[model samples]
Target: MRSKQEYMEKAEELIYKTYNRFPVVFDHGDGVFLYDTDGKEYLDFAAGIAVMGLGYHDKEFDDALKSQVEKLLHTSNLFYNVPAVEAGELILKASDMDKVFFTNSGTEAIEGALKIARRYAYNKDKSHDHEIIAMNHSFHGRSLGALSVTGNDHYQEPFKPLIPGIRFAEYNDLDSVKALMNDRTCAVIMETIQGEGGIYPATEEFLKGVRKLCDEHDALLILDEIQCGMGRTGTMFAWQKYGVKPDVMTAAKALGNGVPIGAFLAHGKAATAMSPGDHGTTYGGNPFVTAAAAKVLELFEKRKIVDHVKEVGDYLWEQTEALSQKYKIITAHRGLGLIQGLELSVPAAPLVKDALLNERLVIISAGANVIRFVPPLIISREHVDAMLIKLETVLKKHS
Candidate 1:
């Protein structure tokens, strides 16, 4: 293979420029660390945007994938597969939802979720004149339908003529949601912890109020758990923290541990919203990915991932809060458990770059100035200390 820089140039020449990707070309990963092509090891705090929960090069996860690959890769969604059935059962049990439909990515799952809401409302009133309430600064997905519900104007501006009837509301303000919500509202969609929107977990009172509004209006409550689910927030799902159950929930990222798989779960009146012909996917719920998901779920139950997250997450909170006091650059801290952020007085991007280049630490930015820390779910206090060392070195230089 060529050098990392050469590979990057090849990619830039071939692939369409969507993401302003980082500089390094990661060759592989082991445990909580990622190694670049040049053999530099970096502490991984981003976890591939909260997807690699079990961490890199996990033996059991790799074995599960190899076993599935040797047996069957895919048979399309036309035929029912055993792994799909097993995974679907596990997902339903974990989510406590009645039905589920798998997709290849979180964005596609959001699309399915939007369809579920609209179809359910149309079934009741025989009208497509329904609106969805999304939160400001919320990031769902980049697809047309999902982008419509996403509250970022920068992402949605160029993609004008998006799907109509979508309204933006404040993240934790129930009154703003109520202001846009009415009889025409079909669903209220939000990230349970607002992952890409600066790691703001909704207040319990606000979540309960939204649930009440949905109940009053007969609208489904859709929670996007794509980034914050699968034990990222010290719970199986962030919404579980508040006890405000969603009528519909979208999950992905760590569901397959690294394999591409996403699902939108539904319950109560929203469960039977979509019939057989309503939604379909080519490779979703196939033997390959579902087997991976089943193994991940089984490991979650067997290993007690959530309890571990809570312990280490509390430690992370204590440590970071202490750092916030020590450093003037840190204005504040937000979030719960592993999905946390430090509100920086300086811009987060340059510090992120400095951490990557100087300290070989991997972190990402949420919004403009908040440094986001979404480490692997399997991270320990030692990993947290490693991250803090690298991060403080970079932050001190910035200060």
Candidate 2:
């Protein structure tokens, strides 16, 4: 086998330079640890950006994938498959939504949700120009349609002339959203808990107010739970905690436990908007991906992953809070369940790099100053203790 440097060099020559990735090349992973090409083990706190809810090398997930591969991979959306049906039913039941449209990724789910909102409005009144209100500092996805509503100017500036009629409002600020809402507004989209903007959970008041505003205006409420959904926030869906139901919601990440699958869910009126031929995908909801997704839901049911996340998440937050109290550099921290963030007085990039290279810990930064921790839902107190030890060492060195 080639050395780590050799593999990285080959990748540099062939792959597009979209990500400023770490130097080490990961070979494989098991549970909460990943092994580099050189066989160096590193504790995984990022969890593939909150996608690997069950961790790596899970026997049940692996066996399900293998069985699906032997039976069928792709038969297109034109036909019905058992896994697809089962996965769809599971998602609807878990989400408390009436209908589901599975896509290949989170971005596609956002795209489909956007289309459904627009079409729903257009079908009602063709003459009115539909407007979508999104939150500032929120991230939906990288695709053009998904990118259009993303609130980051840095990400949207380069790709000018994006889809029109999408406006941005301040997150967690109810008045800002109300100020922008009008008769032309067809939908209001936001993350139930902001992820890339930093792990900021929406206030109960703000979410309830938004829901009321949408109801008054007869506009759809689209919650982008792509990053915070699927038991990441100690619930099957994050919105459940807020006592508000969205007309539409997008979910992915932990939905497949690392398999590439996403979905946009709708309820009541929003659910019936997309008729036949309104929207479709070629390889979406195929047997292979849906089989993996179905298995993930099954494991969640058997393992009671939501309850586990709640207990473990409280422990992790307690540890992180103690760290903040001990170190002045850790200015603040906020989160719910496994998706948490620590805001630093200094930039977090160097610290993240140091943790990976020196402490052999895998973590990521959010919005420059916030260090994000999105570990697998299955991690134990021992795992949290191990991560905190290394993390404290890194902080001490920096201090």
Candidate 3:
């Protein structure tokens, strides 16, 4: 096989230069570890940006995918497939949502949810309620419709004249959301736990208040759980911890255990507005991807993954909290489950680079100054201890 440097050089030549990726080439992985082409090993704490729920090359997930490939891969929405139905059934049963619309990615799910929110309002009264209120520092997606609702000015600045009628509010601040809600507001979208803006979770009281405000105003409450859902934070959905249910919910990331799949769910009344021909996707719920998703759900039951996440997440938080006191450069540690973040006094890019090159630990950043830890749900206590030791040594050296 070619060396890592050889492949990386070719990638820089051929691939789009949009992303400033780390200087490493992952060849294959298992559980919470990855190996580069140079035979170097690294503890994979990023989990492919929170997508690899069961970790790399999970046996059950792989077996399901192999079986699905041997059978029918896809026949489109023109006909029904068993894998798609099974996945949808599990999602609905778990979430108590009335219906589901599958898509290929998180951004597409966001778009579909936004469309449902607006279409539901339009059906009631056209041209009246069209505004979508989102939160500041929140991330929905990169597509035009999803991007319009994202509240970051930097991301939206280049793409001027985006889809209008989208307003911004402060996350976890009930008054900011209430002030933006009016007759024109069709829906309010937000991440239950703000993932990209930093791993800042919404206060329980704040979420309850928002639910009441949306109910009182007759506006749809949309929760974007793309990152924090799917057993990442000890629950199937983060909103479950808050005790508030949204009219519309979008999820992806870990839905397929690594396969590209996203779904937007709607409750009884909100789902009714979508008709047969209103929306569709070419490869949204293909049998191959949905089969992987079904297997992931099955593994969840067999493994009791949620309970594992709760235990491991608490252990990680405690270890990280201790590291915060030992290292002055570390500011704070915040999160629930495996989805945690550490805030640093300075930019964390260099520390991350050092972890990869010097310590052989693979972690990603949430923002400029925060390092996000979202390892595979199958990761054990021993894996956590190993990572913590390497990470702590790197932080001390940098400090």
By lDDT, who's the top model here? Answer: 2
Root-mean-square deviation per candidate: 0.8, 0.8, 1.0
- Ranking the candidates on TM-score from highest down gives 2, 1, 3
Model 3, 1-399: lDDT tens digits are: 767788888899999998988889988997789998878899999999899989998887898899889998888889889998999998888788999988999999999999898889988877754898999999999999999988888898998889989999999888888888898888999999999899999899888998898888888999999999998889889999877999999999999888999999999678897888889998999999888888888888788999999999889988888888898898888898999999999898999999999999998888889999989988888998999999988888879
Residue pairs with backbone overlap in model 3: none
Candidates 1 and 3, the one with greater lDDT: 1
Q: Which wins on lDDT, candidate 1 or candidate 2?
A: 2
Which lDDT tens digits does candidate 1 get at residues 1-399? 799999999999999999999899999999999999999999999999999999999999899888888999988987889999999999899889999999999999999999999999999989979999999999999999999999998999998999999999998898899899899999999999887778899999999999999999999999999999988888899989899999999999999878999999999999988988999999998999999999999999899999999999999999999999999999989898889999988889999999998899999999999999998889999999988988889878899
C-alpha positional error of residue 272 in candidate 3 after TM-score superposition, expressed in Å: 0.8
For model 2, which pairs clash? Answer: none
Give the total clashing residue pairs for model 2: 0
The lowest-lDDT stretch of 10 consecutive residues in candidate 2 is 120-129
How many steric clashes does model 3 contain?
A: 0
**Candidate 2 lDDT, tens digit per residue, 146-245?**
9999999899999988999998899999999999999999999999999999899999999999999999998999999999998998998999988899
TM-scores, each model vs. reference: 0.99, 0.99, 0.98
Where is the poorest 10-residue window by lDDT in model 3? 123-132
Alpha carbon lDDT of each predicted model: 0.92, 0.94, 0.90
